[model samples]
Target: MAEGRSEIRLSPSLRGRIERFLAAAGPALEEFPPLETQKLVSELYVHQMELHLRNEELRRKQVVVQRFLHRQEEIQSEERFRSMAQTAIDAVISTDERGRIISWNQGAQAIFGYQEDEVLDQHLAILFPERYRAACRRKVERRRFSGMVPFPGKAMELHGLRQDGGEFPLELSLSRWEAGANSGYTAIIRDISKRWALTLALEGAAHKWRTTFDAIGDGVFLLNLDYEILQCNHAMSDQVRKPFGEIIGRRCHKVVHRRSSPIDGCPFVRMKKSRRRETLILRRDDCWFKIAVDPILDDDGNLRGGVHVTTDITTMMLAQEALKETLARLKRNMDETVAVLAATAGSRDPYTAGHQHNVAQLACAIAREMGLSPEQFEGIRVIGLLHDIGKVAVPAELLSKPGKLSELEFGIIKSHSLMGYEILKRIEFPWPVALAVLQHHERLDGSGYPGRLPGAEICLEAKIIAVADVVEAMSSHRPYRSSLGIDRALEEIFQGRGVCYDPEIVDACISLFTQKGFSFGQEPFLILSPADETGAAQGGPGPGREPAAVRSEETPVQKGKSAAKKSGGLEGRQ
Candidate 1:
């Protein structure tokens, strides 16, 4: 049966040939081939079994090859992950569920000054300072249980510790991942010391600028293009009589003027339009302010807004006005006093009634013609008005004598200049009015009375007065002589130029009366009293006569000339 089974499994062609042989040698083969056929069939079955075993061994080897390839691929993926972490500029670290650092990359070693081996198995809290470690552990534990991160997927600044026990600022970003059954956290950290320092420096500068802005004494307002107040200092708040919060964001005109529109010729508007500085003086509630507006510009040279500074000048303006009023009052008082003194002196002697008045008017004109300063002219005017003030002491007989006086009377009359100096020297005056009075009779050639001061020694005011005195004396009727006339007066000064009178003064006096048509406004008359008629006939002192040293029309000229002639010449009089 087994031989038959083997024959049935043969190829068709072999089976056909075998069947033919079996038919031919059927009887003969039956006896010899039965054992051979069974043996061959059994050997074929054994070879098939060996081949099946080899095939099963090859299938087992193929399974081993597949597993080896899969393991190699996993190792390459791990190598790539390590390469990326090591080369990253930021520190990379992985912590286990307990917050223990399981993996530390080379970047972590560089940033924290630690080796991978040193940080592994250590608590991740070791990267934070002791003060922050407790808080950090609590936060990590909270995240683990609640599946909530305090700063997940976000970078946060925190204090970090280095291997050398130093602390620095760092930015940290955290994330969570699952490694099989264990949950872990990955942290990316970066050193931020330079950036933090820069931020602090900028904050410091801004603080300094804010401090300076508030320190100004003048009211300062920073305004936008719309004239709205954007920022203001304490002074501005005080100026508006409001708090800083209330003043800000309000229009400047509304705050300052209390109106919806700007004031006329608004400096802020002008500054914006012109892109330049503008200034104006404003008065509000009787207070004055000097307001200055300056435009602010951007980097591109476009107008941004304006800065308004208002300075209070009310006190200064009030002080200036008060000073002007005071000066005017003082001038009025001085003029009234001068007029009274001049009238009193003129009243003492009827013969020289308007003598001082005429001298003063001519002296002022001469001074004006000479282009003397107002102060100089004023001094000359006052001196001329009071030139004969000392004549109050002279006897009226000596003052109004129609004939030449005795030597003693002339000496007494000449003392009037010295007396005038003594009376006025003690009074404080802006100019040398007293000195000019004392020196008025002094001639340029050292030829006049009281003191025969030379031209250089005499003041210009005295020189001008002396010339005016001579001209008026000669031009008017004196007690001793009839009017010498204006022509004779002018000729006398012209002849005496550089001798007794200042040459410039003589020229100025001449020019005024000749070219300028100068005149004493009103002429004065002597109202002779009944006592004066008798005293004039007797040529002696009368009831209303002043004391000895009184001035007369002849006192500064004729009497002086008479004394000079008797003593030889003007140079010899003193």
Candidate 2:
């Protein structure tokens, strides 16, 4: 039995305990049977074997449990990675060394329009457009050899093909990795068709806007809150006589005014404070500009900057000033000419000495009282001075006659108005001076005139002159009569108002002498030459008197000849 049994291996401590047990039991067993001792030893060996077998089985079961736990952890970790990739917005794709698709997440499936089952094991080049397939292959080969990817770890834009054979823009980032002995690649991709289209559209709009800005005729500027120029049009560059590059980014004052600080009443400063538009006329180097500053605001209604527009108005301003100067000069010349002409006409008719001067003064006062414009008043005054110019054509004796004149003599005197019109029509006066001269003798009632013009038919200026003439002729000494007095003159016009005189003119004259306290000066008539005499005769009727008769009716034909000769002389003088 001992030969048949294998050797029992035990620990030193166990063997010590077994030997101590044998020593204590050996004397006790000496009285036992030999067969019984052997049998007991055999049972002790069997029990030791059973304990060793149980320990081995427990160790094997523990190892199996550890493996199972490790595998469960690994499965959970893989699930977490796949879930992250599937939920991501960007497409995630994995490929093996041969460039065959190994993994396609949900994002990849949506972006490529392909199912995972349909794309698995498919070549990665299938997702690339035909035009880009060769380039992709080249990059893959290069990466495998050099351990470097095309645009490694950086996003690149390229064309991608969908399952429906449609192509679109995509942004891709490629990275390489290793799993055991096999190398693979992961690509993070995103569809960028909308982004790219929007970018292109914005670029086109910006280009068009820039083109229009430069094409403007007025100077334009975009300025920040600090008044620094952010952008400027070509017109602005030209306005400042500087290049666009030099003007941009510089302070507006520095660029435009050549100053370090803002100008007084700076429109930009005002606009900034008020958050409103401002306009101003500015002059620089003899040039005038109308500048408009408009505020720029952000989406939140916050003031961001301003836009400035400047229009050149130099030509318009200069033209207006020149027109004003010309008008003033013309007025001065007209006044001087009228004075000279009145003095000349008065020199030929001394019986009505200073007649034209007094009439002109009174007419001007009437015009002022009537609230006439300066130009109208001036016309009335000039016409008053020249109203009797036709009397120069009358014979001196006929003009100075002191008795009632025959019809033939009165006819000759009435012809003077037509003669005056003929003479004056040749000159170009700004106002209707000649026409007023012709019509001054016309009456509103058609009862006292060469033309018999009545009422509104006569010009306003002519009516004013007629009123002044009547007043001055009656108040002053004349060849045909002594002074009738100002009261008699006023009475005559008041009685003849709306009959022979214009009511408006009559009222204005009355207001001037009465309410306005206007009076005529007694300055002696100006004589133009030695030939002009102070005793010269005039042709109009004196106050409240009939037409004067010639001193003699003899030699009527000779008288006509003499009157014609005198008219010619007067015409020559004019």
Against the correct fold, how does model 1 do in TM-score?
Answer: 0.60
**Candidate 2 per-residue lDDT over residues 247-354, each given as its tens digit:** 989999999998999999899999999999998899988999999999999999999999999999999999989999998898788778776766666676775448
Q: Model 1, poorest ten-residue lDDT window?
A: 534-543
Worst 10 residues of 2 by lDDT: 533-542
Model 1 / residue 322 / CA error / Å? 4.5
Per-model CA lDDT versus the true structure: 0.76, 0.75
* Model 1 lDDT per residue over 429-471, tens place: 8988899888888988886777778889998888888888877
Provide C-alpha RMSD values for all models, in order: 14.6, 12.7
Candidate 2, superposed: residue stretches over 4 Å from native? 1-98, 101-135, 141-155, 158-169, 173-198, 238-246, 269-306, 310-354, 368-372, 375-400, 405-463, 490-511, 515-517, 521-574
> Best-fitting candidate, measured by lDDT?
1
Q: TM-scores for all candidates?
A: 0.60, 0.60
